[model samples]
Target: MSQKPAWLTTDGAPWGRGRARLVYDNPWIRVTEHDAVAPTGAAAVYGLVEFKNLALAILPVFDDGTIMLVGQARFPAQDYSWELPEGGGPLGVDPLESARRELREETGLEAAQWLPILEAQLSNSVTDERAIGYLATGLTEVEADPDETELLALARVPFREALDAAMAGHMKDMLTVAMLLRGYHMAREGSLPGALARAMLS
Candidate 1:
């Protein structure tokens, strides 16, 4: 069995929190400001954004080795982005079910197999946004049901091409990048089925 790294296995100094106050609130997020002392012993003010939902991303891989991607304009970045189908899942909901919903809602695809591939804390320094990524395969097409606020475009590309584009910075969503890299790692490390890995790496 694998073990945690020595640094993680050992306890270290932790940040100390002082007074905290809510600075902003919305249906989806809550922002707070806190007086804090760093592990380095320096006093600091910390602003944190807490997401009310768990972020979910799905990499929909088809039997033919292509994957589905969604393109939309991101409000904060004010730029168009091409990413794996992603959305927010209620904190209490099963992430796989949410992933399936996001896949169908955003890209009109449903999968026969789902593999949880990655879990990450997004923008950890400033936000408490957590993300879960899934690898979806054995896909079938259906009608897309995107949210009213979204104006999305869909594309189907080879897995390698998508990974290469993400690596080349054409796809900037960190969750999407991480998922693609994780998928690549799985393919190379024999974590995936032999045929599926061959299809992905081909």
Candidate 2:
């Protein structure tokens, strides 16, 4: 077998004039060039920065008052985390369709209903990427469609308890935490007004 294609690559430029330079390339992820300045002296190349598309995550809250979570191995975090059924945007699938598919594949459950609860962007301050968060409701159990690499399992927790876990830092993903917080606001208002629909776009 041959090596898998690199998502990105960077060749560092020699340091001078309080700046470091690099040429970046990408195939699967978006391609870009980065020339960062240090203000004083050159610093070691941190790594290649990826320009990418919006990610979508589905939060399935079922009628039983439980929210679905998936345990995933996060190499950067160096920990496997518990999060909602969620994933990619590069497949060119409709956002809602992605949400529905992730819900079923990761959780072994499907939603009879779906709701657009919140929209948010993602970044590490230096990199640019956005992730859309969606709230799903009215769910039912079904066979899971794991992709083998996922090794995912579903963990259902009550709404309040999920918040408790989040507050305690168990739910480490910022996108996941943000969506759950948005749901909190919706719950408090007793309704997420249609006005929210317009607000989501901006």
Candidate 3:
């Protein structure tokens, strides 16, 4: 076996945090500024955005290679975006349970099978925002109950079409993009059922 990198075996040197002060706070996030020293021994200032919840995303796929997408106007981007059903789970709650609620609320779909596919840190350099992505299959439809703050549009499209659109820049949500790629990898790697994998890749 190849030897592991020395850095991977232990925590190396860390940035020196001198002083930290909360600059802003809200129910959803908190911003803090820090006086710090970089790993290279350079003096620097750092700002961190701390999230109050964990990010969750769900890719709802039907057995025949179709997937569901949700569209909404995003305030930060100031543009309408099409993405997988996604929302925030309270920090200590089971992410899958929160994902289930988001999928149902946004798309009115529930899955008989669920696979946790990806875990990532979103904008790690500036934020403590982390995300979990799920591949949800064996779908059944029900009435949607979106949150009052959400005005969403739902679409069902071929899985490959959605993946291609994301690749082509039509879909820009990072979580959505990452999950689509992960699903494609799973299908191509035979991690999914043979029929489903064929349907997805086809």
Best by lDDT: 3
Model 2 residue runs over 4 Å out of place are 1-28, 35-53, 192-202
Candidate whose TM-score is highest:
1
- What range of 10 consecutive residues in model 3 has the weakest lDDT sum? 1-10
User: Candidate 3, 15: how far from true, in Å?
Assistant: 1.6
Q: State the lDDT at 135 in candidate 1.
A: 91
What are the C-alpha RMSDs, in order, of all predicted structures?
Answer: 1.2, 11.2, 2.3
Q: Model 3: runs farther than 4 Å from truth? A: 1-12
Candidate 2 backbone overlaps, count: 0
Residue range 95-187, candidate 2, lDDT tens digits: 788777777788888777677776665665446566777877667788989877778767887767777789899888887888778777776
Over all chains combined, what TM-score does candidate 3 have? 0.94
Clashing pairs in 1: none
Per-residue CA lDDT of model 1 for 25-97, tens digit only, reads 9999999999999999999999999999999999888877889899999999999999999999999998888
lDDT of 3 by residue, 1-202 (tens): 2499988889768989889999999999999999999999999999999999999999888988999999999999899999999999999899989999999989999899998999999999999999999999999989899999999998999999999999999999999999999999899988899999998888
